[model samples]
Target: MVDWIIFLPACFALNMACGPSNLLAMTHGAKCGVPFAQKAAIARLIVFVPMIAASALGLGLLLTASPFVFGIAKAIGAAYLIWLGIALWRSAKTLKSEEFLDKSVSMKIAFRTEALLAISNPKAILTFAAFFPQFVILDAYWQSYAMLGAAFLIMEAIAIFAYALGGSVASTFAADKIPVFQRISGAMMCVFGTLLLMAS
Candidate 1:
């Protein structure tokens, strides 16, 4: 269990840290609410943990062995992120700027959007590929990493929930409430996409 003690904090801190994922959650929660954030959180976790586990189990090795495949994935992910950014920016333009959030985004769209946000993040792939191995018990196979993965996901959900709650509170006092969330989300996606392209 020492691995759990050592790794869980690192995982929590890593997840809670400033990143595009948290940025999206905070900004989005501010615009929507707790339910929106929760949906996004759960959807993101469903996609996020599996991908990390895949990498931890064997996909990371595959990527290492096949640079060409990784390159292709990197390119596709980068492009998708930018595409989402453009879509978000366009949506922002469609909606009227209002001080109060008069519009409600459905859970399905929110879930899908958040899932895409989590999946498109190449940094998560790279992070797990690098960090997850450090704590693995060689003989334990999947069990060690599985424990870590569960802890990471739980911590991640809590961190996002906290961020969302804080963001919602901050939103009320925001001077430029209108367009704040959309603009931030759109901008972050574009920035993340560019970063991913650069890293690729």
Candidate 2:
């Protein structure tokens, strides 16, 4: 069995390999700038707390037991992703300048956006259900799970911040191409949403 020291870094690397959420984070980071974008990422993680807890507490099994229930959740998540992608596509040309930063993206908006992307991810929930057991020793399950969750959060946070830094840099240099960046990001999100649906 792999120790946490070995497992967590592997998990972190997997997270950083680029996925829908990571793409969204990178795009949002460019849109909102760094530390603020990192907050949005963390906020999204906060929103997932309930699901994480549920997975650890056996609700994951319960939910999985009912195909109908899981299907509904999966559908809702797919819909939300598609909807969010459309919204991003529609707002591809949102004006951004120095003064605009003041009214740029309210924390509320950022939190909601990130939360939607985070929470609606069925893959995340399923991954938790499947993967957590590998690291868990039921003899000391609760404690082990707690440690695992902490590692997930820590690694995820670090990855988000790193992606945000990359975004901030791109935004700084190609500030004039904000609209182009938004369009590309929006298109990618839409593709991701479609991919999710197809995965079902």
What's the C-alpha lDDT at position 72 in model 1?
77
Scored against the true structure, residue 35 in model 1 reaches a CA lDDT of 61
Best by TM-score: 2
Go through the candidates in order and give the C-alpha RMSD of each one to the true structure.
2.3, 2.2
* lDDT for residue 158 in candidate 2, whole number 0-100: 84
The backbone clash count of each candidate, in order, is: 0, 0
Candidate 1, poorest ten consecutive residues by summed lDDT:
94-103
Tell me the tens digit of each residue's lDDT in model 2 across 72-94. 77777778777877776777656
Report the error of model 1 at residue 157, Å: 0.4
C-alpha TM-score for every candidate? 0.86, 0.89
